[model samples]
Target chain A: MTDMYDFFNFILQIRNFVIHLQCSITLIHNNNMIEIKNLSFGYLKGHWVFNDLNLTVEQGGIYGLLGPNGQGKSTLLYLISGLLRPNEGEVTMNGTSTGLRLPSILSKIFIVPEEFTLPAITMKEYCQLNAPFYPKFSFDELSENLKAFGLDTDINMASFSMGQKKKAFLSFALACNTEILLLDEPTNGLDVTGKADFRRFIASHMNDNRTIIISTHQIHDVEKLLDHIIILGKNGLPVIDSPVSLIANKLCFEMIANGATPSQNEIFSKPTFGGNNIVSIRTDESPETEINLEMLYELAAEKPSEIKQILLNN
Target chain B: MRNNITQDKFLWSRLWMHIKREILSNMKQIRWQLALIVGVVLISEILICSNAYDNWKQNDYFYNSAFQDPAQLPILLAMVALGLFIVAIAASMTFSSLRTKAGKINQLMSVGTSAEKFWTRVLIYGVAPALFFLTSVCIIDLIRCVLVDSIMPIKAQFVIINPFIDETRVKAILLFCSFTACVSSFFTTVSVYSPKHAFLKGVCIIIALQTLGSWFLFRYGNILRPWEYHLDLAYWTALGVLTAIAVVLSVVSYIKYKETEL
Candidate 1:
């Protein structure tokens, strides 16, 4: 009986070792992406902005981080970029803790904060001073981006207006060619034409190795450019975090023409100019439509668990 | 350039580039500071020269008596004090780039290790100011002395002030240099600990530390009498304590710099 007990114990130890090995391998596989695990943070003590939050961002997609005010959308980006630290757990990029601020990690990441102060120097000098740090910085690309934004490289940044400054900075940031780019309120100061240019710049620069996460309240400005959407709910919990393609497959967004009856599968609706916009469960007969960001946000805000269940069921 | 991986390991090339970036980025502010230093020193020295000439013209023997020593001790002391003042200001502004939220993000996100950034500030803000102060003040004094001698009718024996004129003066110079270094490092650490209004905070902390130290010494004077019996031991002990303090402050500054968050 003693021999039998020892044999079982040895087998259990082997099983545990195998499980641990598999976990290690999974971590190695996840090294190429950004991972946030069990992260809790707050500006003040005992007033938690996020509690036990977990997220994973992969490469090759433009992700929109959306939520209401004070939901920690901007704070989350800062945490990922190493501008802030978590009270618990970790945020890692390429298998390294971002909070460490290692040069290896810093060189690969760039963040365009909502409000920034550009030095009182000409754009040419600015590039000369800052571009050497990122080995992949491209002057040609910078010129092209600046041209797209209708800016000149010789202009003095000190004299530019806030909108112009944002454009110049956005041009430079995209030209840096970093692996991960975090943009907060990128279109806040841009004009209508500039906003369209901004979208074009983003769409043209994206590549398979790059991951851009944009946090903005201007959902209409980014809806067309996004391939993934992660919406945060109250207390900084994710209401829905999924690819746009998956969201489109499980749900249908449409404009119900005037005098038409509401569909039986409707989940949420909002009144509009000519008709009512609706988000509903996708059915066999439902024609595919582009995702309506405003309607989708309302649904996620009003019926978070219902949407989560629908996304999970399929 | 193509996408490449960077390492946290110390590299001479990277440090050199980081230092260059710091200088170029702050070139405008540095130029203004340089102008201010030169302007203040020039105006003060000229005033002193003019006042001496007026005194000599009115009372020949009286002015000669006062100006006998070409290397005036008080003037040398004044120059050292000015240098320390410059060092204090420069050191206090070492982390000025971290003052604003945007500036803090730009600096912290720059591609360099924390050690590289810390040492760069120490060299630019702490060491460079002291060197510039020494060189510029000495040259200015030389010019002032020569110009005054040529313009005055009487040979007043006006010459450049030298800190190494005698043994006592040399020792005094050494003491002042050590004090200046300690002050510079203290302000450097203060900049890291308090980036906003760092100069004001540093001054307050210095005044507080001096008062506390004096009080501690007075309170424990009787208990420390044994050290007085062995002067050599006391001297070495004091030196060791100072060296340890400097090292600890530097290490603490580096650690604090590394852990800074927005």
Candidate 2:
């Protein structure tokens, strides 16, 4: 009996060793494109913008970075792009720290800032000069983007209005074909038609190898395009999940009449023009409805722990 | 060894690409403004030279003595001033993009190593502009000589030969070049640190340096005279110190730029 007990203990040890080995291998080949560990950043000392924040963005798909006005949505993007360094902790891309900014790493990322000034040159000239840095840049795709945006390649960028310039820049950025694209408030200066064009342009350009993270307070602009959503709060990230998982596992977004009583499961409700938009827990096996991003963002910000617990429990 | 070589080749290629992009972007943004400024300077210099040539022609005694072995004082002074002015402009605008928040983001986020970006800016705004200024001075002087020769019977030519050939003038030219380089490097360093009003701060520092140097010279004029101490040694010492400062400033600037956050 003693020998049998020893044998079973040995088998248990072997099982533990195999599990550890598998975990090591997964870490070595970490598929997540970006990982932020214990990130603490602030513009001024003693006034923390992000406090001990941690986030992991997987490879591929468009991610909507939503937050309140001063919750560091833009700052987070800047840190990931290596434009702003975190006070503590680090931002890594595929297990490499972005702060190092190696040529190999830099070539794989592009950033489109909210307010950027283009050189006073034609779009063709700009591309000719700047495109060579990005190894995967495609002139054919640039041409297609220009055509789609109704912009002539030969037109001087200095003459372009703000909206036109943004369109042209967005087109160029998409054509650069970097693995990671970080856009901060990209649709701010865009018109209604320009925003639609922007959406189409982004959707057409996305590939399995590419990941685009757009940080914006305007959730409606990017709601339909997002595969994953990250809603930041005053302290840390409260929500980091795909739309499908969000709709299926945690919350049910519904539009009810103005005078109708909300169900007991309804966690949050907001008044809309025609009725009240309500977010409740998913109970039955019915097909998930489309998520209301605005409502989701509000619930996440105001009652993060409640929403977090529901998500975790589900 | 083979992998290392391939990596080096890739790095060099990327550096070259960045340099080309910087040059093209600068040309697009500032070409017309640069042209206008250069045109104005050239015209003004031509006018001044023509007037001096007329004076030399009118005064036979002054013309005969100066022309016998032209002093080249005015030409030398013009060249020195032109070199300083060109370097000042280049240094002032080298890292101007850092002044604006948007420009800083655009610049720092671009694809390239920090070292590569530093060298690109130095090549575009420091070395290239200085060389262009030197070439312009030589060409303008040649043109002035030709104009004088065409107009006057008495020939007074501003020789276009290399300054290194003249043992007497070599030290002066070298000193001038070194001073210009030092100033340029210093201002470039200032641009990296001072985000706003960089040009103004740089000019103020230069003025302060000049005042201090003048005071030092005045205070020790008798003790440090050419008769007591070897003038060549002093000149060489000053050049060495200035060159050291310039190199140190450039290295510091590059390191600061690498760590700069927008």
* Candidate with maximal TM-score: 1
A159-266 per-residue lDDT for model 2 (tens digits):
999989988999999998988999999999989988998999889899889999999977889888998888887665545445446655677889999878887788
In angstroms, the error of model 1 at A183 is 0.5
Off by over 4 Å in 1: A1-32, B1-5, B52-59, B62-67, B153-170, B217-238
Please provide, for model 2 over B12-54, each residue's C-alpha lDDT reduced to its tens digit, 9 standing for 90 to 100. Answer: 6666777777777767555664565467457756666666666
* Model 2 interface RMSD over true interface Cα atoms: 8.4
Task: Grade the docking of candidate 2.
Answer: incorrect
Model 2: how far residue B19 lies from native, Å: 3.1
lDDT of 1 by residue, A1-314 (tens): 99997888788568546644654675667644798999999999899899999999997889999999999999999999998999998998856679978777799899999999887788999998888888889999999988888888887898999999999999999999999999999999999999999999999999999999999999999999999999999889999999999999989998988899998999898889999998989988887778988888999999999998999896
Clashes of each: 0, 0
The per-residue C-alpha lDDT of model 1 at residue A151 equals 89
Candidate number achieving the greatest DockQ relative to the actual structure: 1
- Chain B TM-scores per candidate, in order, are 0.83, 0.84
